[model samples]
Target: MKNIIGAKLKAYRAKNGVSQFDLALKSKGKLSTSTTSTAETVTNYDPRLSTFIEMYRYVDTPFDELLTEMGYGESYQSTWYKRHKGNS
Candidate 1:
C-alpha cells in the first residue's frame, strides 16, 4: 500500500501548496531524537502516519475528510478483517 500512501501524501502536500522537501522537514521536526535521524532520511514521497498527522494539524481539512479524499471510507474495520483473517 506504499503507492496508496504516496498518492495520499502527494495530494495532501499539493493541497497545502508545500514541496516534498518542506514536508520532509516538517515531519523530521515531529520525531524524537532517537528517530530524528531516521526520519530525516526519508527522501521519497512516501509519508508516515505521524507525518500525515502533523500535516493535518497544519491543514484546514479534518482527518476523516482527508481519509475520504484518499479513498479510505468508513469500512476500515471490515477491510482490516478481510486482510488479516488468519492472523486474527
Candidate 2:
C-alpha cells in the first residue's frame, strides 16, 4: 500500500517540479525531506492522512483522487455504492 501511495506521490512531485527539500520547506515541517524522499521511493511509504491533506492543499489535487489512484476509490463510485447511498 505504501509503495502504491509512494508511486502516486512521486508522480505528483514530478508534475510539480518540486524537490524533496522544497516540499519539506513548503510544508513547514508537516512533511520532512526524509518523509518526502520515502514517499517518492518505490517502497515503504504509507503516509498519514495529514500528509495527504497537506499535499492536496499544496498541489490542488483532491485527496480522494489520491485514494482513487491507489485503487481504493472505485467502490464509492460503483453501482453498489450508488445503491447504498440511495438507501441512506
Candidate 3:
C-alpha cells in the first residue's frame, strides 16, 4: 500500500512540475518535505489527514477523485464527501 501510494504521489508531483522542496514550501508547512519524501520512498505511508488533503490541493486534483483512487468505498462520496467538505 505504501509503495502504491508513494508512486502515485511521486507521479502527481511530477505532473505538477514541482520538486519535493517546492511542494513543501508551497504547502506552507501544511505538509512537510520529509513527509513527502517518505511518501515517495515507501518509508512512510501514513501521512496526516491534513497532509493528504494538501496534496490534493497542490496537485490540483479533486479530493473526491483521490479518495476514489485510494480504494475508498463506493458509498464514500454519498456518505462522507458532503459532510467532509461542509456541503451538508
Note the Cα lDDT for every prediction shown.
0.53, 0.68, 0.67
For candidate 3, the per-residue lDDT at 84 reads 62
Per-residue C-alpha lDDT of model 2 across residues 1-88, encoded as one tens digit per residue: 5356556556767888988788788788888888777666646556688876665665544655666766677665878765675474
> After superposing candidate 3, which stretches have Cα over 4 Å from the reference?
1-5, 77-88
Off by over 4 Å in 2: 76-88
TM-score of each: 0.40, 0.62, 0.66
Segments of candidate 1 deviating more than 4 angstroms? 1-28, 31-44, 77-88
Give every collision pair in model 1.
none
The 10-residue segment of model 1 with minimum total lDDT is: 31-40
Superposed on all Cα atoms, the candidates' RMSDs to the truth, in angstroms, are 8.9, 4.5, 3.9
Model 1 RMSD to the real structure?
8.9
Error of 3 at 79 (Å): 4.6
**lDDT digits (tens) for residues 1-88 of candidate 1:** 2223444455666787876667656766663333333333444534577655664555566555666556676665377655775683
